[model samples]
Target: MNRYQVATAELASSQKSGAGVPAYLRWVNRGLGRRAAAVAYVAGLSPNAVTLISGMLSVGGMVVLVFLPMSALSAVAAMVLFLAGYALDSADGQLARLTNRGSIAGEWLDHVVDSLRLPLVHLAIALCLWRAGLPDWSVVVALLFLVLSSSWFFAQTLAGKLSAKAADDGSAAEGTPDWVSFAKIPYDVGTLYVVVAALAYPPLFLVLYTGLFVVTAAVAAASLRRKYRALLAEQRDYAPEN
Candidate 1:
């Protein structure tokens, strides 16, 4: 097999479970990322280098969103940049796994970039909405979205780490429904970036953004509670008898 084909096979073998993954990431982003990862492998780029490139692309998109005057062209530019960056974000991990070069530091850097970028992206959207002379309520929605997205990111990450530690067997649970992925479109970061393209039309953007925020907020709340309770139960199970 050619080098690219070899890299593709390696990536396919190293992939994480698709359980609970959003449809866009599982289907679109991962496919794009696999190709990108194969290219990066052939180019001899390190995983960390791919990550830094992703960060730069994401920041460029945010800069355009916040700094450029709102217009159809700028909105499309931001969306393309953000989506490309997001695809590369997936590629970094795949590249790491393919090369067996995944490190604690690499994972930490990836999460740090994601944690910071998510909130800042929402903030940039808020700034744009305020500058665009949209209703005050619309700006408030953006700010609230920033808060919710950050909280959800933290909670979800912590819960995953804790649950893995608490599990008696390291193996992951199975049987996730296929529809769950589609149902999580509102919670997908890629979906959020796709929505950014609508920013050129404030009324349309507001309607879509607000709807996403509501669904994500509701889902986050329930998921947080479930995680907390599960952790508590695990703790009790592991507790020594009195």
Candidate 2:
């Protein structure tokens, strides 16, 4: 459709806000992403285009992590690419909401890309560390980190779906304060910023990544366990009486 038609379509679902976003990413998603979404809308670009671009950036960043020197400059370049990719990731969804043009297929593709990237990125980092002559232990730690990270992401997705299914009004949970957002930064997907920064110094990167992996594994495990129990209790409480 033309720009005017796109603008009109956008107005149909034009709230353009995100829920439960961390403060660190709030600026990227709400600020930069929104600006990009506006331009995309005017340019008549579909959300799918934005999604594909995001995927490309992410894939390129992973490639760099795997193949390039683990130098500061390389880390910076890869980090910039990742940041742009993530911003576009947010923008695609925003654009979809704005234009009321979201589709199940689009959402599925977005999540699929995300699921692919999360573990692969870590594995790439591990490979980079090994190439940098880091200890074998670090490589093992990185592999373990990949498994935990992917499991955590999948668990959170499942929890979100279950929560949505259980909510009677179909409304999202209430938003938390900015401090809570800050507290969550370590666990956020955008924590890759921290990852890339750490990579610039391989020794520090190993420690930071290992620490994050341990902490994240604990947090994800607890959250998933609690959510699972709650879901079980709900099912039992609502089970049909004989």
Candidate 3:
């Protein structure tokens, strides 16, 4: 609602100091907001506004692609809209910092909106491939990417938790996120390549989608094994002596 109210709401979920939002995201947010920089000054739009609008754009883009498969031009436009949506998604934290009003609702909603984008985009891809007479395997691979990517994120989170506990017990040093918030590496690279392939040549995207899925699956599996071992180790330390 207001500045003080927003800050109070955010106190529940605010990131710890030094866990600031990543710079690449900040850079994207700043660059894209410049699209409406003068207007933001005049209208006083905040980060959540930018984020929600971008989410809408991403959804709209997928809807359009689903129905307008005949034109490569339209597909290109949809992908571009989705990209803009992601850019605005990046803008939210910076917008909060600049405005000094951040809310947990805003932070949570940013992720909720983002979570919807990938599934919808995949649906659009499945529709496109059906038209091309591709095998169902393509859709399966796409789903694998989403599922494995999610598992990888969760596995990494567990690893961090374990590391922190070990540090607390004096078994190790305080753990940091592996690298500047996981580099958004899989997402930044996967989305760009997928979008490019979708617009220029749909088959190219299918190939990239499958390739990325394979790589991500391997990474997720390895990470899961590490997390499982960590959990076992933690449990062993707590086992009672007979």
Q: Who wins the lDDT comparison?
A: 1
Lowest lDDT block of 10, candidate 2: 164-173
Off by over 4 Å in 3: 1-42, 150-190, 193-199, 227-242
Q: Give me the displacement of residue 216 in model 3, in angstroms.
A: 2.1
lDDT of 3 by residue, 1-242 (tens): 75544543443244323332344343444455444432443367877787788788887777766677636777677767777776666556656755676798897787677666666676666676666567788867666566655555555555665665422322112353537534544444335433543655757676677765666667557656666766677885665659
lDDT tens per residue, model 2, 93-192: 8889887899999998889888887788788878988898999999998888789878877876776676644222211236645566676667677775
lDDT of 1: 0.88
Worst 10 residues of 3 by lDDT: 165-174
User: How far off is model 1, as Cα RMSD?
Assistant: 3.3
| Model 3: residue 188 alpha-carbon error in angstroms | 2.4
Task: Identify the runs in model 2 with alpha carbons over 4 angstroms from their true place.
Answer: 1-20, 162-175, 237-242
Write candidate 1's Cα lDDT for 201-228 as tens digits. 8789999999999999998787777777
What lDDT does each candidate get? 0.88, 0.75, 0.59
Q: Pick the candidate with the highest TM-score.
A: 1
Model 2 residue 182 CA deviation (Å) reads 1.1
Looking at candidate 3, what is the lDDT of residue 128?
A: 62
